[model samples]
Target: MWLLETTTLKPQLFLGDSTPYYAILSHTWGSHDKLQNLAGYVKIIRCCAEAASCGFKYAWVDACCIDKTNSAELSERATECYVYLVDATDPSGFGNNRWFTRGWTLQELLAPCSVIFFDSDWNEIGTKASQAEFICHNYVAQRMSWATRRETAREEDLAYCLLGIFDISMPMVYGEGRKAFRQLQLEIMKESTDQSLFAFSYRLNIGIRPIVCHLLAESPSLFRECGTIQAPGDGPAPEYSTTNKGLRIELPLAHCIGGFYSAFLNLTRKVCNIREL
Candidate 1:
């Protein structure tokens, strides 16, 4: 493990079976370019100071601890790091903070068994364990909201950064564009039994929402009887497919007032007007 020296801000590597206590830093990088040099050390310093005050001898700041130049190392660290502190505070307060909207931060929020939120001034706010009920209740919806709006420098990272949250691993293919997200989702379906993974973007027909329902309905037979099932015997499995042949419905044209018809089609193709009141 490599840690940043709290005072000197230098890198220190440790190796052994004895686990040395360390604090991990989690914050949204406002600009990717800012993280390329020591000028971005402000967050690292604050995290180190906060960790030291908490009796932690070392800390891990993602911006500095991981060598972004090395893709394999970066992916490895992202997959392995599970304990972290989220810097959620802003001048406007936690609700308006960028940390909650960044693509990479999703895993930072979900994977950590122990997560502490800190204010802009490095003051303690709350812990994930304390907010378990609220998080669990809104997990799927909140995650969907996060994934939809979060930004990433590399488009593929929107899905790559979520690898930890879904407990899926894949080779990092940087330039795959939206296909990376599709691959990520397929991996999630293969490993997970959660149907909610398909419940995304119901409000936008052009997005992943429309395709996910078909994906879920056509998932391997293993997902048919229950939420989960064992892989079939060593032979060719059944194939699944779908098509967009379009839908039609009959309704009173008089009821389509105030442009409701236009908005309805934009939302979903499966739903159409019916004559029955």
Candidate 2:
């Protein structure tokens, strides 16, 4: 793993288990970094400067630190993360910050065990623990909703960035288009029987909606309003699998008076913090 020495701002190599305490810098790519030389010249300097102030000897920024030409990656084991909110000048703008609207930031938001939010002036605004009431936990659909409004320059990255959030690993194939998201769903189903995964909406009236399907959502945007959807914690998830025809699953189907059966999904939603099935 490579970590930047806070004082000299030079990248240093650290092998397994010998890595020192480090803080990671997270921010929106294009605007915050100013994109001087593709290494995010301004952002890196400010990030390491903050690390040095906080008594951290080393820090990491995704842009210059990772070798995009190869499979090199930043260490995920780092527990402390510093979130640089370049768009927000004050703490009041936290809710409307551009940081929440980017695809890659979703991974950065969820991965760190501790996060310190900093304003554009590099002044401390908030910590993740300070905003506990607004954060959701554990539910699959809610976690997906967090990324629905986020975006990436590449269509494939919308799914690729989420690989770590779901604890799924797969080969990255760039030219696959929306199939990448579908493949991600297929991978998620393999590890979890959470019926909430299928509870996403179709993003009614969005511009240029993808060809809709009943089995899975075409994009994460369909899950925008699903933050309230809750997983069936102890409810038995029906056995399901993918087949040549489509997704095959055993759902409790009830026939209505019109002779149409409605399948009962093993999922619920919270209203006033109370679960309703």
Q: Find the candidate with the highest TM-score and give its number.
A: 2
TM-score of 2: 0.85
Query: What are the TM-scores, per candidate, against the unseen true structure?
Result: 0.60, 0.85
lDDT of 2: 0.77
- Candidate 2: list runs displaced more than 4 Å: 15-19, 30-42, 72-77, 203-212, 232-236, 256-260, 272-277
With a 3 Å backbone cut-off (N, CA, C), the pairs that clash in candidate 1 are none
Q: Which tens-of-lDDT digit does each residue in 1-277 have in candidate 2?
A: 7888988988898776788878898887653345466346767888888789888899987765666654326325456888887778756667578887888877777778888888877788988788766677567788788778788999999898888889888878889999999899999998887888889877466454334356787898888778888754765666788788887888888765545566778778777442110
Supply every candidate's count of residue pairs whose N, Cα or C atoms clash at under 3 angstroms. Answer: 0, 0
> When superposed on Cα atoms, how far off is each prediction in RMSD?
11.6, 4.6
lDDT digits (tens) for residues 173-242 of candidate 1: 8788877877776676565433344444333355322222343322111112122112224333233222
